[model samples]
Target: RQHSAQTRWVVLNLTGEAKSWTLPEASGATAVLLTTESTPPTINGNALPLRPNEGVILAI
Candidate 1:
């Protein structure tokens, strides 16, 4: 979702096991804005690791 000058990305892992999500190509760097889990998984390049039932909001 985009609003004003900020673009937000929402990622969720609904499966029972860990998963990796490939993020969309962005013009600028991305960062984790919010997460549902206590320990958020690391962002590997454009790929994000997400635990089961985890969700995150990213800023780009």
Candidate 2:
């Protein structure tokens, strides 16, 4: 979803195993605002790793 100043992306790992996702290109910087997992949020380059049944909210 998009708002006046930022875009929000919701990513989920529905499978039982971990998964990696390449975030969509954004006009500005991106940050992980919220996550289901306890670990600190980190994105490797543009790739995000999600544990099983995890979800995240990204802002750009």
Candidate 3:
């Protein structure tokens, strides 16, 4: 993940299927789904679906 101080935004790269990470500092922080090769992604046990090749910014 890349965090930009200038934009105050984080860029997360999630690949493959059924992948998850423990982001303690990401609590209450927003997430933007940059890309998806197949199925959508989930954050914090919540379902955040996205279309193929879609760029959707979501609030996690």
Candidate 4:
């Protein structure tokens, strides 16, 4: 638990009009990291697998 940070999220500020971004085509990046955490997530809970879809951003 020492090096672990219970981050609710990692974020960047957005200052622009509404538009959809296609990563590789728009930004010319092969991949993007969502967080600084080196270890990837795995299934460990007693629940169904997640269904991927549009990401949600919330204002704190």
Report the number of the highest-lDDT candidate. Answer: 3
Total backbone collisions, model 3: 0
lDDT of 1 by residue, 1-60 (tens): 855655544544434233334445673445544343423444544444654346666655
By summed lDDT, the worst window of 10 consecutive residues in model 3 runs over: 4-13
Which residue pairs in candidate 1 collide?
none
- The reply for model 2, stretches above 4 Å from the true place, is 1-3, 26-60
Deviating ranges (above 4 Å) for candidate 1: 1-3, 26-42, 45-57
Model 3 / residue 40 / CA error / Å: 2.0
Clashing pairs in 3: none
Cα error, candidate 3, residue 18 (Å): 5.4
Computed on alpha carbons, the lDDT of every model, listed in order, comes to: 0.46, 0.46, 0.55, 0.28
TM-score of each candidate structure, all chains considered together:
0.30, 0.29, 0.51, 0.19
Encode model 3's per-residue lDDT on 1-60: one tens digit a residue. Answer: 986544234555567774454445745455544455546666566555765565556544
| Per-residue alpha-carbon lDDT of candidate 2 for residues 1-60, written as tens digits (9 for 90 to 100) | 857755544444334223334445662445544343523234544444655336666654
The lDDT of model 1 is 0.46
Model 1 TM: 0.30
**Which is better, 2 or 4, measured by TM-score?**
2
